[model samples]
Target: EDSIVPAAMYEPLVKAFGDAKNQVSLFKDIVLKLPRDNRATLLLMIDFIILVATNQGNQMDMSGMVTALSSCLLRPPRHLQERISAASNVFAIIMFFATNRGTFFAPEVSSLTQFLPPDDPALHQPYSNDKAEQPQQTQQTLQTLQTQQTQQPQQPQQSQPK
Candidate 1:
């Protein structure tokens, strides 16, 4: 039952963003309100940013992309940054999308790199290491959290000592 909720939430999001729209601000508003713990919401926000950055048509407004990317970069949750850093595929996709359209803001890209700790162990690891490892790490972490969520039954709270 718990597993189904995530899949369910993602399906509609993918459908809604199937096409790019100028209503980027509205999308940003909705994303801001979504629960921080939900991976689907974060993915949806990423997808939305990608879509805006890649849109070839005039309907694709870069302003929205800039706004969304700025918001995400300002103080992204650790999990979301981990997800982005892990997904090399997302970078390729974003580049491909941006190339045909125009170009993504360089500052935004640079800002994202700051998401990682300056001395992250991954930075010291060999560059030849599998690029796919980060995504797998993210998935494993998310799964562990989800499993914990499902297994831990809620307990009624006792009044605390004043």
Candidate 2:
């Protein structure tokens, strides 16, 4: 039983992300001292969040995950504009999540998005696309919504008496 995924394996991650929601500064401090290798893993985690949201964009609440990633001190800000173009996929993702949830995380992701010099183009992007979608995914999403609606119980309407 213990050989399976361990609770300890996810505890710190949950804690870090949870804390990031309430106090971004604290989350920043915790990750600030982590070695470069750990920081690289953190980047993977950010990518994972984007991937999940893209795949399950309409099903779950990813605002917190996006917020945590934005809050963390991933990389120094400098190549932000360049990175955006390089990782167009990831760029579209965070943007998708931010777009659906309104401008809640825009200011934070933009303000926190920055990287140091010497890196040709690291990664990042958001917004600017009013219409960004793949035909297959859009079709699948619509079908799923239709199925869900049919499965739910319809509410009864009340009548008013004159």
Score each candidate by Cα lDDT. 0.43, 0.42
* TM-score result, candidate 2: 0.26
Query: What is the C-alpha local distance difference test score of candidate 2?
Result: 0.42
Q: Assess every candidate by TM-score.
A: 0.21, 0.26
lDDT, candidate 1, equals 0.43
Off by over 4 Å in 1: 1-37, 59-67, 72-162
For candidate 2, the per-residue lDDT at 98 reads: 46
Candidate 2: residue 120 lDDT (0-100): 23
For residues 1-162, write the lDDT of model 1, one tens digit per residue.
Answer: 132113233333333334366334433433334443332333444546666656787464654554445433233234444433423323432333334322222233222232234585643554334677888998999999999999999999999999
lDDT by residue (48-145, candidate 2, tens digit) is 56556677545534555564454332222333324423134233334443443222223233222322123524334342334356566789999999
Clashes per candidate (backbone, < 3 Å): 0, 6
Extract clashing residue pairs from model 1.
none
Off by over 4 Å in 2: 1-22, 56-162
